[model samples]
Target: MANKKPLILVTNDDGITAPGIRALISVMKDIGNVVVVAPDSPQSAMGHAITINDTLYCDPVKMTEDADHKEYSCSGTPADCVKLATQEILHRKPDLCVSGVNHGSNSSINVIYSGTMSAAVEAGVEGIPAIGFSLLDYSLEADFEPCKKYIKAITEHVLDKGLPKGVVLNVNLPKLKEKEIKGIKVCRQAKAHWVEDFDKRKSPQGRDYYWLTGEFINEDKGEDTDEWALSNGYVSVVPVQFDLTAHHFIQDLNSWELND
Candidate 1:
């Protein structure tokens, strides 16, 4: 008897040709059949945005013609790619949908603005087990070798155990040497945010325009947070839920009187 292979869907916000997605595709190939439908260009910080205002494009492409996977380039957001993969690309519902291997961190508050996580969340809405992986290193040429093995292990675990409905994993790997990696930790998102700074610069027209810039501020010192785990050389896996309702606060709001 042979083991049943899982069908995997791969995507990234950093475009179809990015090294991040390539690394992810290579790792997934070892686990199951991979079908990639990724953005044609970098769509970082796009959040859960979908392309509804214009026509979308998706062309079938062979990322690596080896005996493992098939790929496609999508002219839309990360969320768009996931929808296309589910509807037109894959023959049936995928066993798993993994997004990113993002070039930069999607930790803490940044997860709300990440195109990488959007793809995974989109899959989660469709009842597919999903995960989004990120590396703390933001440079395009940053070393990804340290993440390969850990990625494989995590993917295998999710494929075997399966994920909770309406929930998905957001995994972040620290930028450390392989030997320096402590271990993996299931954690919560830290209370952190970017202190926004708008860099004012004059263009050729002498009009000032702003380029957004900011620094990450980690206010939470909890040991169980994703920030703590990554800082201490551990892979952080945070279970993310899509329901945006603040259930605990709803009752309190109803108790207040309205001036209207």
Candidate 2:
């Protein structure tokens, strides 16, 4: 008898042609019937943005023309791609949504600026279990072989166990050889920040422009954080939630005199 397969929606911020997404697709094919709806161009640091001012478009692309999976290239943000997949592309709701085998890390405070994480978060908001995976290396030619087995394992686990409602997994893998990778760790996003330094320069016309640059600073020394895991050569999975309300602070604020 044939095995029952899950239906997975695959997307990424690094455009459809990115090697990261290609590696991701290769793994998902083993677990499900995959449908990929990804941006036509890289849209890093888009941070949950949507294409409100412009109309969105998607065209089916033949990545491997003879392959069983269906893929599309979309002219929109990562969030827009997820919206299109959920509302317009798929015939039914997907069992899971996996975003990003990102070319760079989206761990710690970087999640706030990540198009990768935002796509997964969008799916979580629509009540789909989601995950975003990234490797610590940022090079376009970075080897993803080390992450393939772990990625497959994690995908299978989520499909089997299912995630908690409204919570999506943000997984970051270290850029180490497969043997060097210790193991997986369920962790929290570290309390960290980027110290921004904009490089100011002048064009030939003497107009000033700024190029964004930053260095990451981890304030937390906790071993139970994504940062610690990556630094220690382990795959980190942070169960991220979409709720931004500080429920613990509501009662403290209620005691304040507002009309005094």
lDDT of 1 by residue, 1-260 (tens): 03878899999999998889988988998888888999999999999999989999999887655644678899999999999999998999999999989999998998999999999999999999999999999888978889999999999999889998989999999999999999899999999989999999999999989999999999999999999999999999999999989999998888886655
lDDT string for model 2 (145-247, tens) is 9999999999989988999888999999999999999999999999999999999999999999999998889999999999999999899999999898999
- Model 2, position 56, has a per-residue lDDT of 85
TM-score between model 2 and native: 0.97
By summed lDDT, the worst window of 10 consecutive residues in model 1 runs over 61-70
The candidate that wins on TM-score is 2
The lDDT leader among the candidates is: 2
Per-model TM-score on C-alpha atoms = 0.96, 0.97
Residue 167's lDDT in candidate 2: 94
Error of model 1, residue 1, in angstroms: 11
